[model samples]
Target: MSVEQVSIEDLGRELGERIAETPEYERFEEARAAVQRDEEVQSRIDEFEQLRAEFMQARQSGQATNEGLQRVQEAQDELHAMPVMSEYLDAQDELEDTLEAVNEAISEPLAVDFGGEAGGCCQD
Candidate 1:
């Protein structure tokens, strides 16, 4: 028996295309677009980011940022409360689970593990 020669890049590209065809991926894209169009959601996200930065800077400078931390938590909650953001988060989880399953399937035969490795867009 002869093993077939195949390009890893081609296989990866085909896998990506197949994943993109899934309904979960489509929903993820739609949810992301909805979030993008929501000004309130975007502002809440920006607020959390700015507060987080302030908290980090305070930590770096050995200063207190309890207020910033509290504000960041509030902003995070507000962002999470948005319907569009909630939908986006749900879709994101679904897509991530699907990709993890695919990665496991592909890595199993190759005797490798793709879980917990950094550098992917879904990095935790």
Candidate 2:
């Protein structure tokens, strides 16, 4: 009897590409750009810290805007969509952290702060 053995390396390469081509992967790629800079993800831990500080300051100063909040939410969404592969997990973590910081930065601020504030009530 002959036995067939599959090497882990071969399996990994095959699976990696297959998984990377999924719609989810495409979404991940789109969302990831928001968090990655220079091919390196920002430190999530530091992002959280900065976020907290900024949030507190913004709220205290009453400088919050809707756009700011939207930016934070976008980061949060990106974090949720980040890739889960072992090789990419670290980068994901960085993105998550940066998102947290972004959230803090936008908290207490209206989304309009980022731009394009809705002007006047619509009467079309």
Candidate 3:
């Protein structure tokens, strides 16, 4: 079929489906699942999130201290030091790299960057 025969949304959906079948995506999914199943990692993530939230709240209320921010950072560092979390982060990076390559391929043929310009303004 001609390119004009298919809607851009349909093409985008097909691309998404194909991406989901890729090895990088599969690895990322598996790693993420493993992270979810690890109780220790989950507990650490929860603690870190709680610490971050409290720090944010304190900052908003003008009561945040340097020590509070340092604690949040330390908690984050400790969380990332876990083997499961490391694997998940690596998988995530690989998947992001794959997506970036795909974005470049899609953007190369167009006058404007497909991923950047296709949003039609109001992008954050």
Per-candidate local distance difference test: 0.86, 0.55, 0.94
TM-score of each: 0.83, 0.29, 0.86
**Clash total of candidate 2:** 14
Worst-scoring 10-residue span by lDDT in model 3? 111-120
lDDT of 1 by residue, 69-123 (tens): 7877888888888899999999999999998898889778877666656345754
Candidate 1 vs. true structure, TM-score? 0.83
Ranking by TM-score: 3, 1, 2
- Candidate 3 Cα deviation (angstroms), residue 59: 0.6
* Worst 10 contiguous positions by lDDT, candidate 2: 110-119
Candidate 1: segments with Cα more than 4 A from true spot: 1-6, 115-124
Q: Give the worst 10-residue stretch by lDDT in candidate 1.
A: 115-124
**Which candidate achieves the best TM-score against the true structure?**
3
| Candidate order (lDDT) | 3, 1, 2
Off by over 4 Å in 3: 1-4, 121-124
